[model samples]
Target: MRKNSMKNMRINEEVHRELSNIIRSEIKDPRINPMTSVVAVEVAPDLKSAKAYISVLGDEKSQKDTLAGLTSAEGYIRRELAKSVNLRNTPQIRFIMDQSIEYGVNMSKMIDDVCEQDESKAKSREE
Candidate 1:
């Protein structure tokens, strides 16, 4: 498959789906929480490497635990992914913690606070 080809996109999606399933159903590591989710997947042009972005809905400790579980289960996850996708070469899986969701929420809260303050200031000025 060419770099960034349609096939690559499809492969990324497939990997993402299969990896999520594998993580959810197959792996039984205690470190991994059920709240974990696959946020995104990025595959290399050669299809030899895949990075899975995972979001853990908990504190920092739980997030670290989930990542640790994923990191240790990389071999099994890759094997399952290959079998599930029927790929000639199984891409090495890498787990990364994704915090974009939390960041967005925090940013939204800050914007709301600023807006409320601005409205109060405007009201005071009018008064």
Candidate 2:
């Protein structure tokens, strides 16, 4: 059997926490929704770049606007990170919208509708 070696998950978790704090407190962009959360962070082995998955609790337009705001404020975010974390090079931050939450909500609704239909059919059969 072969074992797979991977980058440190703790590093990724630390980065996610620090980035989330920087965005919420340091970044003064009003376009960003307060409800925005950092869902996950993936850092390359070389640590040159990081992709941040964000979940926004709002409509599609708000999510799009929030992403745009984050993209434009990337430089400021990176600078703030330098003061907090010591690294040879600050990884570039990329914001991506996470739709799993929305997908799960839709799937739950579909399942509820199917259950209601089954109950209605059962009642009619009894009548």
Candidate 3:
């Protein structure tokens, strides 16, 4: 079974939401940023392990610290997942830093700048 199918996507979304809530409400690590979000979740077909991609709305230090804190609390996170979700086997949680959102934001800013420059050039040419 391919990992990108609708079923997998649904599972990923559910896991993402569950993990995000668990991290925010249950995990008491000070390193975690208040604005952290679980961007995506990738789970193995056998459900043995899961990689949780998290995005932190802060500087690099905050992102790194959040990842470190999540890594340290992996065991507890998995335990909580097992207790919350009715899965046959709870996957081991691995936290990874996700920069896709930041990249998208930067890309959008660049596009806007280019559009403004083009508009200015066109106006100059017309004048």
lDDT of each: 0.89, 0.85, 0.88
Tell me the TM-score of model 3.
0.86
Number of the top candidate by lDDT?
A: 1
- TM-scores for all candidates? 0.87, 0.86, 0.86
**Candidate 1 on 54-102: residue-level lDDT in tens?**
9988999999998998999888887788788977678988888999988
- Candidates ranked by lDDT: 1, 3, 2
lDDT of model 1, residue 54: 95
What's the lDDT for residue 27 in model 1?
Answer: 95
**Per-residue C-alpha lDDT of model 3 across residues 24-75, encoded as one tens digit per residue:** 9999999989999998899877678899989999999999999999999998
lDDT of 2 by residue, 1-127 (tens): 1111243465577789999998788778899999999999887656688889998989999999999999999998888877787766778988899988888998999999999999999999999
Candidates ranked by TM-score: 1, 3, 2
Candidate 1 Cα misplacement greater than 4 A, ranges: 122-127
Instruction: lDDT for model 3, please.
Output: 0.88
- Candidate 2 has an lDDT of 0.85
Q: How does residue 127 of candidate 1 score in lDDT?
A: 100
lDDT, residue 63, candidate 1: 95
